[model samples]
Target: MTTKNVNLVSHPLVQHKLSLMREKDRSIKGFRELLNEIGMLLCYEVTRDLPLEMVDIETPLQPMKAPQIAGKKLTFAPILRAGVGFLDGMLALVPSARVAHIGLYRDPETLQAVEYYFKAPHDLSDRTVVMMDPMLATGNSACAAASLLKARGARDIRFVCLLAAPEGIAHFQKEHSDVPIWTAAVDERLNDHGYILPGLGDAGDRMFGTK
Candidate 1:
């Protein structure tokens, strides 16, 4: 489903893997592998509209014009720990894409995002940037990460997550309406502690076997 700035992937493969991830008894290795597979699928969805240009090429039989992605190589910016889970799969699809790391953690009491580290290519303004995370619950961390990217001159930015809550999507649109969001599913709502209910739990914990 496509909304104003949110795109729900909803592919059968994505939905099936997501349901497996949501199971409380799923093994850490299984969860990690599934997340990686979904990341690759999401990467395919988000880059579907990237511009393409025809180039001269020679097939074994004859010469021909072939299509290749146009413009500068894109960048994948993952939001710290959980976001890293999506990195390998995305990189596997776009091996030449650049990578930027944005480290932000949510404050438990206030449910706000706090940044601790950031690093990116200096030519961010020249390339498309995709910010990634496993979950978008409160939306604070995603917004903060986008703001940081903007400050660094990232003009074309996109956000991708595994799951999202309605409140989180609303909050994100209110803050960064221009940045599009892509996810597998938008669940019911946030709980008292600012977590997506029926979410796959803390993604970082499940992926890393942490408490």
Candidate 2:
């Protein structure tokens, strides 16, 4: 079942940590840490409704039944550099999850996505895919990346990001309404160059100290 498409994770801890991440002068190390920490928290919300199955297990003494996540394998596909920042934190929550990488960058004037790299494990139909990226500004790259995955046979896919813009969300839903969006905040709007205003700047630069 397709859960509600867009999710705004407004938990207090998420909000406070996101605030820390938005500071322009914040150190790269500090921003990276907060990104991962918040990624874990968002992971909690994204996986909340995953199916569970009961199984018999032996405890310290007798055998008893316990619930475990249904055998729905998970794949975390991060969109290149910035998205990688959220992976470690998410792995802490689901170490067994496979990782996929999709490399796409926006064209300067046209703002369209150009793919550079794509990789995934086999049996895409059996696994749930979570696309990770720190910022969803114009939604070009995210939508393009999700389309690539769908072309490869992935049926269950969702998106997770730290920040989003309304224009981005609308464009994303228009293209891929079946995929849900989980984000920490939806800022005011995207600036002329397609950057989210009041956003934490270029996520790749902030995460990697490139700018």
Candidate 3:
């Protein structure tokens, strides 16, 4: 089955930054910053289809007409706690957007996603929601989170991330055919350890300086 849509942006800035993020030796600060920056770039691609409506407005010297987003409330949902790293950058670009958080972890044995936290806007059904998670390693967590969001009545869902492995993307496609993915890079595969091959390591640990 096809997932709604998965778009891997190939812009130069995104590609260069993603390469840096994939290096094992990159500094934690650098990695975190790149995640945020890439998130913004991905945000641009993800929001491209947002509907706009023409509006007449006053400019510094005269009245001018312009278009602004029309008829769609936007909600930015970040999968915690690593996803929080991308949240700030997205918010900077979309200051008026509402925020949601999903906290889940995969069981080492069962490999099933277990949700421990989830909170979103009350009017999710009317909003266009963008879900952010930096790494799509196994796709279990992201897919599960997306399912939860759909259950909460969110429509026009978009999933954005920094890196994705083919395995992860395939898994997401199977599970979330209704939602399209927007990401910077799709890596080769997942390693035996559940890490994406050549991945920068645990995103949360690197972002927060945790061991």
Return the top candidate by lDDT: 1
Cα lDDT, all candidates: 0.95, 0.92, 0.87
For candidate 2, the TM-score is 0.97
What range of 10 consecutive residues in model 3 has the weakest lDDT sum?
1-10
Q: Residue-wise lDDT of candidate 1 within 87-200, one digit each (tens)?
A: 999999999999999999999999999999999999999999999999999999999999999999999999999999998899899989999999999999999999899887
Candidate 3 to truth, TM: 0.93
Rank the models by TM-score, top first. 1, 2, 3
Model 2 RMSD, rounded to 1 decimal: 2.1
Worst lDDT window (10 residues) for model 1? 1-10
17-119, model 2: which lDDT tens digit per residue? 9999998889999999999999899999999989999999999999999999997679999999799999999999999999989999889989999999999
TM-score of each candidate structure, all chains considered together: 0.98, 0.97, 0.93
Model with the higher TM-score, candidate 1 or 2: 1
lDDT of 3: 0.87
Per-residue lDDT over 1-211 for candidate 3, one digit per residue giving the tens place of the 0 to 100 score: 2434778799999999988887878888898899889888888899998999999999999998899999756899999889998887888899999998899987888777899999999889999999988889899999999999999998778899888888888898888888888888777778887888777788888888885
Candidate 3: where is the Cα deviation over 4 Å?
A: 1-4
